[model samples]
Target: MKAAIVPALNSPWEIREVPTPEPSANQVLIKIGASGLCYTDVHITKGAIPTQFPRTLGHEPVGEIVEVGVGVTSRKVGDRVGVPWVQSGCRRCEWCLRGKKMFCQQQIGTGVQTQGSHAEYMLAYADSTMLLPDSISYEQAAPVFCAGYTVWSGLRFADPKPHEKVAILGIGGLGHLAVQYSKAAGFETIAITHSKNKEKLVRDLGADEVVADAEALQKMGGADVILVTGNSYKSASAALKGLRSDGRMVLMGISEEPLEVTGDIITNRSRIIGSMQNGDEYLYEALDYVAKGKVKVISETYSLNDISRVYDRVANGEVRFRAVITDM
Candidate 1:
């Protein structure tokens, strides 16, 4: 089997023939149909995520089950599934017992801790794999595993009521899908971005209005819930003023700088929170929305052979939104 391996930090991705892995107890083997390339892969390559060398750094994959382990009863061969960020969590952990699997300290990250789905075949725990709806194609289902799941889970956790304004920061990957989800969930959707070029695109994605910056968002009665999807700490911090009194702000992207918690943030009783990918339940919800046409995942498709080139595009922000490696 040919796979892209990161031999070292800050090194180029190498596609080499490696032995394909077989499914273990409670695991299933998947023939990958499409894999989503995320910016976090760049972080891993730069040694920011602290993964071991010679790793395959892709987690968002949609594929078909080629074989199922003897202990796996929930899934069978010939089933279509999606492998998400959280591969598996220790079932005995308190967080996992409470249904908050992402918070489990013993969680296993698909690409970060173990071999990931960047090749023709990858291993996924049967319990962690999401059964993809037939209506959702592999290309569309791929990004929902990570980018879509993150934003959708964040928005749900924010818990905005009907008619409450929800502002999605950034117009790329996650933000684009957040706009659609926010609208479908009955929130008065707003798109906040520094780029004026995305105004039209965001509006077309179901946003009720587009604001150039956080200040403009404040002028529109402020957002009841602000979902931060941009990677810039400065931009996210400045957007604090856009939150309405007692509103909540969810950070879904990683930022280098700390968010300034000024007196104003405290006086307004605004809440700042961070959310990661949830359990299989959230993944199913993300896919359900996509299957029903409530959300549209915009992505550029690349062949598995061009994994390195696609990584370069993602790192340089050249891809319009999410990039998926298909044709495996």
Candidate 2:
């Protein structure tokens, strides 16, 4: 089996032939069809996300189940599924017992702490695997595992009202999908970005309006729910200025610096919240939306052998939205 391995911290992806892994009693073995490369992959290579050496670094993987372990009944051979983040939590914990597994401190994170999907074959915990819809291809469904799932979960965290407006900050990978989901839900969607070139693309994705920044969002009568998808905490901090009274700002982006909160962001108990992949219900609905064609993943594809080149492109910030590693 050919797999891309990160030999050490700050190292490039080395394509090597390794023995295929056998699934454990509670797991299933999959023949990976596609994997999405995220900016977090670059951070992993640079040791920004602390990870063990000689690791596989992709969390967004969709493929076919070629084999299943003895104890697995929920999934079987020939099943099409995706191995996503939030694999499992310590089932005994309070959060897990209460059904809020995403809050479990002993949660298992794909790629960051386990063998990821940057390989031809990998073992997945049967319980955490999601059954893929027949209408969505592996390449298109790959990003939904992380980018799509996170933004949608953030929007849910915002809990917008029927007449409230939804605004998306940053028009990159996650933001692009956020705009579509916001519009598809029948809200007046707004996209906030400095890139003049993305106005048409954003509009084409069903953005009802486009704004340059926080100030521009304010002029349009503030948004009831703001989903922040850029890694810049300053941008996220500034975006709070555009949140209407009692509105919620859901931060989906990960940043190194502290997110500053000011008096302007505190009107009528408005909330500043951080969110990631939420409950299973959110992921199920997120996948359904994309499967039904309400959301689209703008992506570029590469062969598994060219995984290193994917890194270079990601480092140069050249990916249109997301990069998928396929047989192409």
Candidate 3:
């Protein structure tokens, strides 16, 4: 099997032939149909998210099951499935016992700590794998595994009231989906960005309004819930000024720099919260929204052989929204 391997930190990615892996008792082997090249993969390549050398880096994978282990009764060969970040966790931990496995201290991250779907075949813990809906294509459903689920989970964390103003920061991969979800959730959806070019695109995605900057947001009386999807700390900090009193700011992007929070951010008892990859229940809900066309993934597709070029495009933020590597 051929896989894209991170030979070492800061080194160029290499496409190498490797031995196939057999699934363990509680795992399933999948023939990957498509994999989402996310910003998180770039972080792994640059060592920002530390991991062992010679690792395979791709967490959002939609594939067909080729083999299942003895203990896997919920899944079988030929099952269509999608794998996310939470590959496996210590079932004995308090968080895992309470059904919040993502918070387990001994969580194993797909692509980060384990062999991921950057390869033609990979092992997915049967319990963590999500059954993909037939109505959604593999390329489109791939991003929902991570980007879609992240924003959906973040919105749930915000818990906005009916008809409250909901603003989406940034207009990239996650931001685009956030716009649609916020609109569907019955909020007066707003897409906030510095780019004038993205206004029409955001509006087309069902945003009730588009604001150019934080100042514009303030003039509109601020948002009740702001979903931060851009990785820029400066932009996120500026966005805090546009949150209404008692509003919530949900951070969904992974940034290297610290967010400068001022006393004003808390004057109204506003909350600054963050969300990680959610459980299977939320992932299914995210997929259902996509399957029903309520939420869509704007994406570009590439062959696995051209993963290096695709990686460069993702790292440089060149992909319009999401980038999926398929034809594997």
Clashing pairs in 1: none
What TM value does model 3 have? 0.97
The true-versus-predicted C-alpha distance at residue 178 of model 3, in Å, is: 0.7
Give the per-residue lDDT digits (tens) of candidate 2, residues 1-328: 8888999989878999889899889999999999999888888889887878899889999999999998899898999999778788899999999998778888887887788998998788999999999999999899999999999999987788899999999999899999999998889999999999999999999999999988989888999989999899988888888988888989887789788887765555789888998888888889999999999999999998898998899878888999999882
Clashing pairs in 2: none
Clashes counted in candidate 1 amount to 0
The CA lDDT of each predicted structure is 0.89, 0.89, 0.89
lDDT of 1 by residue, 88-123 (tens): 778898888998777888889999888887888998
lDDT of 3 by residue, 1-328 (tens): 9999989997888899999999889999999999999999888888788899989989999999999987999998999999989877788989988988889878999987788888899998898899998899898889998899999999987889987899999999899999998887778999998788888989999999999887899998999999999888778888888999998999988887788888986578888998876667778889999999898899999988999999999989899999998878
Q: Give one clash count per candidate, in the order shown.
A: 0, 0, 0
- Give residue 179's error in model 1 in angstroms: 0.7
Candidate 1 error regions (>4 Å): none
